[model samples]
Target: MVERKLFAGHAVRRLRRTLALTQAAMAEALDVSPSYLNLIERNQRPLTATLMLRLAETYDFDPRNLGASEPGGGSDAIRRRLADPMFADLEVDRAQVEEWLAGAPGGAEAFARAYDRMGQGGAASDGAPDPASAVRREIERWRNHFADLDAAAEALADELRQGSGDLYSAMAERLRVRHQMSVRILPVEVMPDLLKRIDLHARQVQLSESLEPASRSFALAERLAQEAQGEIEALVRGAGLDRLGERLYRRHLTGYFAAALMMPYARFLRACEATGHDVELLMRRFGATWEQVAHRLTTLQRVGARGLPFFMLRTDRAGQVSKRYAGASGSPLADAPGLCPLWGAFDAFERQGDVAVQLAELEDGSRWLTLARVVQPQGARAGGVRARFAVVLGLSASDAATLASARGLDLRGVAVPIGLGCRACTRPDCPQRSAAPGGRARLVNDRETGLSPFGFAGD
Candidate 1:
């Protein structure tokens, strides 16, 4: 068999720049001549296995990352973006898109961002970035894993476990002892609009009485995570976000810390593997909710002790995505403005509380194993209207064999064809398309209509 040489020049250059090392200095550290190192960085030479081992040993970085494509900047994403109606006249091809990504990744990212801005009603008039999008980008850039926070939360979890009580009791006790604060579950009438509030003057962490036991524990953990303000702030600062963006990101980081505390990395991973990535089983073991477990699954990218590289999406009934995290799966579904109605997430609402699984094939021929379920948000009024949501967790179908959720399934069977959205999708024969595809000429005939409402010129 011919050896597949790794041409990861951009990754090498990125690493070199991140280490703040001159080419010559990096070359010396890698035990390679500067000229050869330059060749390696320029794609003129393949990164040999021996050199990969040396790079890992000397730099203490993940070798796998050298070959991983940037999220939302891969050739598939670029090709999909170029398929927009605005670029239809350009007639960009797959090879050209791959060349662009390979030769100038930064340029490709800029193009993707510009296209995204156009899709989102063009760049801001005042040039202010959207805080939500900015924060999502930062999370994607980190593959939804913060190692330092994970470590800190794991250590805290160990300390909390030392107490001879439930996790929530232990956390409350720690708060009372360490921070001189007591937890009080106030009645709904007392706190009608607030789920949780920290009264500094009274030295109490007050939560609404309507909160479930799991939510109560999560609220306490979120408060406890604030104790790591220094570390979390350091990350927020490093994100280089605007004021609102920083605040939003800090909240997200606090939630991450809470999740990590609730489901410590090592123990959670073991439970997942043992249960075949069963969401309900993990929730039962960790005293968490389904949404919490699904979200935590996406953050198990902790290097050597990694879990499945799951990507999660949470959307309302109308398909408005509220949260998305594309771990290491490189799934573009997380980046789409809207989801295809044909995906399993929509079906989850119909099944309501039952797990819906699908083997979905994208336009780019990538297959994903998606597990979706409907979940009610944590806080709901006693007899008032409540909202429901669908949470979809997916990973590459190639990795589906290891999941208990995917067991006894026909991995080789036909898959449901899905796309990013009606506008961006190029699937011509989809019966569920609500709008005409971007780059296709609509086919009009006086006497004929096809499966899709909007017939278009085929590729």
Candidate 2:
């Protein structure tokens, strides 16, 4: 048997920089010569098991993280980026991509960022930033968790004495007593175009009667999040967003605060574990909607008592993604331009109100346990038409044992092959291929057609 050498120089260098330690200092701490440390940092020497143990003991670092790739600098991301038509003539190979990532992860990350910006239509001609992309990146950077907001919300939840009575009533009482505000459930006819409205003169937070109990409670929580304006505003100011992006980020933070208040991190995590992450059970327990529960599940990133790191995506029938959070799962599907049609998110529309579970295998052979369910927005109705979306929550299939949703599944069976999207997917035999792969040349024949509509020459 051959042993695989761990050449994680980039990770070591990054760790050293993060600790603000010079190479000599780190080498001294590791009880290694400076020349040997230099060789290790240059990938000329492999990281030994003993050194890994030392690192864990000395720095309280997880050795497993050494094998982890930087965001957007992984070989898979590089390959996907190279699949773009713009790189067709480059002839870059997987080995080269891996080598680049290993040798200079920083440069690889810069390249990834440039490629992503180009994919997002590049920078504005007038030098203006794309606010939506900026906000998404900001959320991704935080891994969808705001510790300060979570702490504040948990404290506020305790103050409200949540378990003693209904949360909505408690929130309303708090508002009335502290803020001198009143809560009113107005008929839809009275506020035809609004779900929630705050009247300063009336000193009332008016909610449309169409809102469900959960939504009404959320509205009250949102209003209460304003009391934590200083915290949310501090995060917003540090986000480096322009006026529009700042506004959007502020709204996102407000929503985060509201969800945290509704679920209260410590208690919600306990419920999630006790129920095996049953979304419906959580909805009933927390007085939240299905979508809200799914969204909250993505934000369960508290340090010591963390739940499963789930990536979430909300898409419509047309396959348009309305919301996405990668969380800590690091699944490329969260960042894909288009989702695979074969994924259960699309199947969810066929079985509305039922959870559709899929053990989806991406082109890179990474398996994810996905739970998809169709949800109709609370007040999204017009002329008798209801707007619907599929909320898909996923985590690495290896964690299926901890996931109740994946119970009774055949983990060893042939998994459903999915991909990032048709454009970047390299699966030559996928019947559902909508577009020819980006860098492949079409193999046109007059006499025959393959299983796929678009056949291309193999690499």
Candidate 3:
């Protein structure tokens, strides 16, 4: 096992800022000397396991944020910026950059912010202003677990489910009794464009009749979230997001609440551990769709009762990503555009029922065991063609043995090399090159045939 260190100086500083506590005050709370805390904040000392536990217990810190190389949000973007040719003469290394992130994350962010402002006025910039794409990149670049929202959802689950006769029934009862809102199963014709809708004027929550009982219950939970929207908004406010971002996070939290209500955290973790993270069995047990099960697998970041840190990717037939979730910051799956078409998720479209098991190696030599399959929309009428989407669930190579899908596979053998995307890919001999790499590339024709469609002249 590779040793994962705890270089969480930035996290500690962030926590202190959030609590509005001075170094001495935080030291007193953590039962550490002020000088020790100072050393930790300066990246001069690594946090011990005991101190890490204390930090979590005292401040309700999410354990995932304390990783040695945890992305400090702007650090990854800064690293990408530094990779530009403008900084080629500078002696910058990963270790130095990480230390800069740990010791002075705010300064790094200020630099990025200033650089972005300078780029807005027609100045030369490393990257361009693609806010829509940048939003997606920023959102998926890091995995931050908000413990306040999670605890709130878990508490609601505890209240709704008593002895667990039927979780759906319990939720329905809670909705009826507490909110006085009735759930009606309306036909698809009545609610054509949307899956669920709330009529505040009539105090009725309407769901599509074609949905299964589990889906209906989840829709009702989403309505309940609307009724209790204030609570979600409060959590979003505490999350330290901007005004626009808070609105987006509020919607995300509501979906999170629905999922948490469907499958309680403790029960879900127990089921995952018992079944070796089997997707099919979990779907059957939880009455969730394949996509729902896969997405939930990424959100199991509870400090004490955590499951496998699996990242999820869902893409359409055109290789455009519809949804992506990372278990933690700096996920390899978040790399964009040049995702090799050879990924098994795309293959799942051709081979419908069969699961595509792959041992994929990234450009950085990190390997992952991925299981992918296609899932169609549930309850499609007999005469109509259903929309199919591919979902891929993967984890680091070390966790391959723990997954049932990885069994009977030669994981140690040569694995397929995949890139971030076609534009960012650097593989010189890819047979499936749809386009050339990002920067300028010299053409090498010489009136001679080559294996690849586009060949760089220098090579």
Candidate 4:
């Protein structure tokens, strides 16, 4: 069932041994602890771009064979193995599990093997989940999106898939290959030739003579957008998923295709199934940063096939919502549009790029299997301008039933309130209201003596 393009977990582990370096020695050389080195060897931690570079420089290792793509199962097997019952008495946190996964890959395996034999006593299942059922569940979860898009894009992809106008055309074709849509990227060289003049009648775009590189790139994208308009519109129509907030939902779906193309659905779905949903494996398999993988997981609800229903969100350093891909169920974060004070775990990134996993209950009664990590994005080329991005992955309350982490609390009635602000939020106890939802209105001051941000009638 494993794809050839995917990097093998055991293969990577074997690479570490082939080098003749012990875990402790490698850890010392890498300026990381022994445990961390072990995790990378076991494919628990993504041999990240940073770690991959370091391994090559220090150990004369060739990580390219490990590739930007990776095979997913080895690590998932490791995780399920770790949950073995022999340690049923021993309590373990997911973060601690990840840290060990990151640093002591091989040792983690040994420990898991020991734990498995001692506890599980032959608990492994022989059969894989029915691929068809997985697909059907995914379709139902996504509400039947694939059929509609396939029906709509069939003709367009056939026609435009062969056209070779620009990078956008090429990018569109790439999308077609993956999603059967004629979507392609606009290359840098010819981006300037694209004109902004939109022909509404023919849906053709004429390029202006003066655009620079960035503008041309955008223009080509604009034209591609125009060319694919009918198809895109047809896709939305085809999706049987009814949404609570239709406008916002549509805008989000439009973004979904963009994100999906950036991280193709089939490649990603297969990888997740193979990796057993190991976040690190997905990251490595896609050559995407941790944030990208986190964002991608949320979009799995697209085609209604092969996906675990989940809500995924992300925040930045100042707690701004840099990205949120919450399909039918939107992100839980509120208060700040770009910056959210609510998602505090992302703050851990400044410490040492560690992954923090938690089962959190929002003010509203929602439970989440939250995985957070810090990531620094290198510029387009090597050593380009780098910016750190915080990534968070979340699954709804019910889906977290198997994880024994959350405290013994019935999360069914729990409510995590989310709103624009005090004026809009209607939560009277908020002390940090900077502005009212509407005009200058004053309400009760729960923290102070006189008034809150939405104070009683001008205070």
Candidate 5:
């Protein structure tokens, strides 16, 4: 028979040493006697139940792993803290940090890392991001945009569900009555607001603004969506999605109308399913960019139609998180903590010119299938410098099995150790990083390297 042992005494000793915290400090945090902590560290005495709970609850350490077990998820987040310069001020030992990570996990670190990343702040700058103001702007925009769309969709959904002769016909009838002009799409070179009403001679249409290919496409889509609002509403209402699921469903419903007016959903869905979610095929079918194809793919899950549920995020080289949208009828990530290393989505950007596909599991014990690739967009006309953005999409692992990559891998009952690669991340030891944003030392620098990148409170 095999013999069992106590928790990882080595890990306890190591974590304390790495944090550069003295035995007294550790004792204070754990609410235990310094002598008791010293004895536990030296393995002279086992950690008691009260001490264990204190470590887990107070300092956010895991008591189970204290006996002796490999670290599970969230170790990356914890490890990132060692990279902080604060540790350097006190001279935390590297061996100690590694040993601590090798210990057992407390709870989920995925959410914790995300919260830390976004909440971290630095010294003041003249023209930097004002998080408070930025959040207010985003909230206001969402309230206005979503509230209006929700009202419009609700009215149309009720109208069609109550008495539907045909979805598009009703919406089209309403549009013609309101605008008194038929929807006509012309090739690019012509639109100036991108839409307009011509009062010349007999009668005519208007162009709101001159559009580049992408903008022109969306313009046509918007008009199409307006024309077929009734049909789209019917499709959304019939889906029977949960509240969060319904929000995502309706958002996609509107997008479907826009895309359909251009490429048509029936045709696109058939083509996509036939091709097993091939980007090239979908892009060619819709005359869209790779990013657009990725965004559109997230729209397939509606009305329990059994489509892959996906979330999409787009960011530029400057690290501006421009767009983020969740797809499908449901997601534990419908409210993901935001970008964090434990998630492993950013690893896709390692190779500048390649598409990186990865399977990631969150701290919640749920798995996500991800596809990430970079896109370089040229500026409009003349001489605008090239711009680059990384786009990523993720979905529930089970819903993505139609793809061959996820088939053989045992997503459940298995834990994968992923690294957090940047101080910008929850992962530590990412040499590629120059410094944390806002020029502060990372929260984890050890004493030897007194100059850690940047220090953020969440760490």
Candidate 6:
């Protein structure tokens, strides 16, 4: 009997496209020649075991599918959707499904989304959580980085820049002069549940008195963003998307403008470089919150004056990632699902004010230095829900020497091994492993149990 070689050209192509890498770039990362990758993509050559392991190690790929031992297409999702009782009588063949997935991947994905939406509640899904999930997935698809908006924000910052002056006051002044708007800081009792509200008819903006100066200034900048809505909307229009897409874009734009106004690009970039990208110093200097400083740090991509490329991750106490930002130098941490419980982000909750520094080694053998600190949301004076989350700022291990925060620390010694998510991670000895991974078969032992709850096939 002869064994057949499996070809997964589509999956390889899809992974490369998801990473936004060119053939040459993807090939280099996979440690293969571009021509060889081309052959593999064309199904002219079978994806080898060595190449499969490389893909799993370097990227968020399932090792099981890399071998093509089972079905390796969108057929599974489509079949699952078709299996629903709503389509109980309908007949679909495996070949036809494969054909659709192979030829029309986007349509297949749309079908999945539509199927999901239908099951969740359809047109009535309005005001429901489905759109929020869709919006989040969309943001994740773009790695939470918007180039056009980032450029416009930098331009605004440059225009509003002053020599050793307060940027927030400058923004307020601009709003008053250009838009005929009055800014008022009202008492928290009067404002109550609202942090800021714009009375467009009255041409006045009211903010809560309970907020700190930074929060008040950010609220003012957001009002200014509304004043420039025409300009901002024009920029958003060119980006091109559906109604919901425009909403997400506008929300991001509002926040971007606020951050830019709070920490004008030129001055902030200079200060970041001078302070060796110190978060505390930046926060104190700009009168911004730790979350705001961390967010602004990810936007320091101004052509010749670019700061060190950084990625920001915000997670709640439960370890669910809520917000993420990837810089222009290319998002090495883009779509990174590794939420290792041991990450300092979780530890920050217990550590209180202290920022925890950690060195993380990924499955690919690449390393990053992560700084984690807890952030408490303001505007809680109204008895509103106050949510506290941890924000982690990560930079390449190579950039540690350039940072003052990591000064005098032995970068080589305290390194921790981490994986993506439990379902996707294959770390066998991880005592923190919560679930079995996809590629490996779970081994059940009635006789004895180990430190880790689950064991894989090899173990």
List the candidates' TM-scores in order. Answer: 0.88, 0.83, 0.82, 0.39, 0.44, 0.68
lDDT of each: 0.82, 0.83, 0.70, 0.47, 0.50, 0.69
Better of 4 and 5 by lDDT: 5
Question: After TM-score superposition, what is the CA distance of residue 226 in candidate 6 from its true location, in Å?
Answer: 4.6
- Candidate maximizing lDDT: 2
TM-score preference between candidates 4 and 6, better one: 6
Query: In candidate 1, residue 61 scores what lDDT?
Result: 78
lDDT of 3: 0.70
Off by over 4 Å in 3: 1-4, 14-38, 49-93, 110-144, 226-231, 239-244, 377-386, 457-459
Tens-place lDDT digits, model 6, residues 22-121? 9999999998999999877755687887898899989968754332211212343355445332343345656777666556556776776665454322
- Tell me how many clashing residue pairs each candidate has: 0, 0, 4, 64, 41, 1
Candidate 1: RMSD to truth: 3.7
Per-residue lDDT tens digits for candidate 5, residues 256-334, read 4554444444455677677777776677655677777776666553222334556677766444566655543134333
Candidate 2 RMSD computed on C-alpha atoms after optimal superposition onto the true structure = 5.1
Worst lDDT 10-window in candidate 6: 65-74
Candidate 2 stretches greater than 4 Å from native? 1-109, 112-116, 119-127, 162-164, 380-382
lDDT-wise, the better of 2 and 3 is 2
**Residue 210, candidate 1: how far off, in angstroms?**
1.1
* Candidate 1: clashing pairs of residues: none
Task: Judge candidate 2 against the unseen true structure and give its global Cα lDDT, from 0 to 1.
Answer: 0.83
RMSD of each candidate relative to the true structure: 3.7, 5.1, 4.8, 20.6, 16.1, 11.7
- Candidate 1, residues 1-459, lDDT tens digits: the string is 133466677788889999899999999998899999988876668889889999899989777566443534455455645555556557788777656656787887787666554444356666766777667766766778888899999999998888844999999999999999999999888998899999999999999988888899999999999778888998898777889989999999999999999999999998888888988888899999999999999998765587887899999878899888877666878666558889998999999779999999988888999999998865677687798999999988888888888888877689999988887777777888888777678788889787877887766
Give the alpha carbon lDDT tens digit for every residue of 1-459 in model 4.
Answer: 111222234444666578787778767877878887665555455455566677689868755344311221133334333333233234455566655644555666565444333322343354322322222222322432333333333343344435753434564444446434332233434444343454445434444444343333334333334334565665445432334323343444444443343345665677777666777666555444565566556545432353655555555565555454443333333112223244435545755567765555543445655567776532233445546666766666666554333345455654333343243233454565555443334556566773344444431
- 255-318: candidate 3 lDDT, tens digit per residue: 8777776777888889998898999999889888777888888887665666777888888888
Tens-digit per-residue lDDT, 216-263, candidate 2: 999999999988999899889877788998999999999999999999
